[model samples]
Target: MQASTLAALKELALQCARSAGELSLKRMKEPFTVEYKTSASDLVTAVDKEVEKHVISMILKRFPDHGILGEESTFAQDPAQFETLWVIDPIDGTTNYVHQQINFSVSIAVYHKGEGLVGVVYDPSRDELFYAVKGEGAYLNDRPLHLDRIVSLEEALLCTSVFWNKRAEQMGIDLIVKKLAGKVRGMRLLGSAALEMAYVAAGRLDGYVSLSLNAWDFGAGRILVEEAGGRVTTMTGTPLPYNEKSSVMACNPTFYEELQQYLHVAENTQTD
Candidate 1:
């Protein structure tokens, strides 16, 4: 695609993300209904659907031909084959939103032929927007974001999510967290993958990992973190696929290799 086209789409994404985020913020202060997706812990709120539909409508209004995939809608369908696509998570932390009334976000990323071109993640509560375009720098709000440090695992503050449904998967996740609890400065379950990655991009956290996450959960954050000079890959250190469920390890450059080693140790312990 032409540079101008990409820039236009990036601007559109930013607009949509901010609008959707504000909608979520308004809902945060009001009464909302909750519905369970797979289990009680895997949740959806009325606001999630409303914001997602609104974002999708705006994207299509501007670019009717572009495809859309959202967490609250179209998640089950395959989106990777579309030549041009918008992947969005209207509310990334529904549980947090329902309970803490904070820590949620709206994430949007535009892709051409399965490669991300524009990414925007907005935290309405903090009024922070983390964004990037391919080959351009990343930013948090108006400030340039730089994942400019390398810290050892002992000093890294890594964030992760735990599975609630699959016992096998949850067990593996527990083992990894158990192994890292003492070695890392701290581990946090922010309950929002997008926010966790935004924190990593801003250098507030050294790394973020998850046993498995959907594309909408991390697509925007991946671009922001990578453009900020960080690396993202699977726990075993492979490319993270954007179309399906997968594991992830996003880290500052100085800590990727060490984090990978620790992940390997955790897996070994889980198996043993």
Candidate 2:
């Protein structure tokens, strides 16, 4: 795609994210209904669905032919079928939104033929917007985001997601967290994958890892971190599949190899 087209998509993503953020902020103040998807801890609120509906309507108004993959409503059979695909998560930290009322965000990303073109993650409570355009750069609000520090594994502050189950996979994740905590400066679980990844791009966190995430969960975040001069891949250091659920690791380039080694050890040892 042309640079001008990519810029246009980026602007659209920004508009969608900001508008969705405003809606979420407005709805959060009122008492809304909530339901569980998998467990009590895994929740979906009426506001989540409402916000997604509002965002998708905005996108279709601008680009009626574009395909949409959204967390609350639509899921295309194959994103590759469309020349342009929009992946959206209206409320990324739904649990945080329902409980803490902070730390959640609206995430939107545009992809052309499976390649990311633009991304925007907006936190309404903080009024912070993180955006990136392919080949351009990442930014937090008005400031450009680049990981300038050379942080080692020992000095890195990391964020992660914990599985509530006690299955072998959960054991493996626990092992990884235990090992990383021993070596890294600290660890946190922010309950919102998009915000956590945006934080990494903003240099607020040195790294973020999750054993599993859907495309909508990390679409915008992956682009944000990469455009901000960081590395993003699976825990095994392979390319992240654009349309599948998979592990994600977003981190400063300086400490990627070191962290991957720990992931390797935990994956090999704890699962078996």
Which model scores highest in lDDT? Answer: 2
List runs of model 2 lying over 4 Å from the truth: 75-80, 163-171, 266-272
Q: Model-by-model lDDT, in order?
A: 0.83, 0.87
lDDT of 2 by residue, 1-272 (tens): 87777777888899999999999999988999999998898899999998888888888898888888888765535556788999999999999998899999999999888898898999999999999999889999879998989999999999988444364254567765776798999998888899999999999999998877889999999999999999999877888877667778899999899888878865553321
Per-residue lDDT tens digits of candidate 1, residues 160-180?
774342543545666656677
Error at 256, model 1, angstroms: 0.6
TM-score of model 2 (CA atoms): 0.94
Q: Which stretches of candidate 1 lie over 4 Å from their true place?
A: 74-81, 163-173, 265-272
Question: Against the true structure, what is every candidate's RMSD?
Answer: 2.6, 2.1
Measured with C-alpha atoms, the lDDT of residue 233 in candidate 1 is: 86
The C-alpha TM-scores of every prediction are 0.92, 0.94
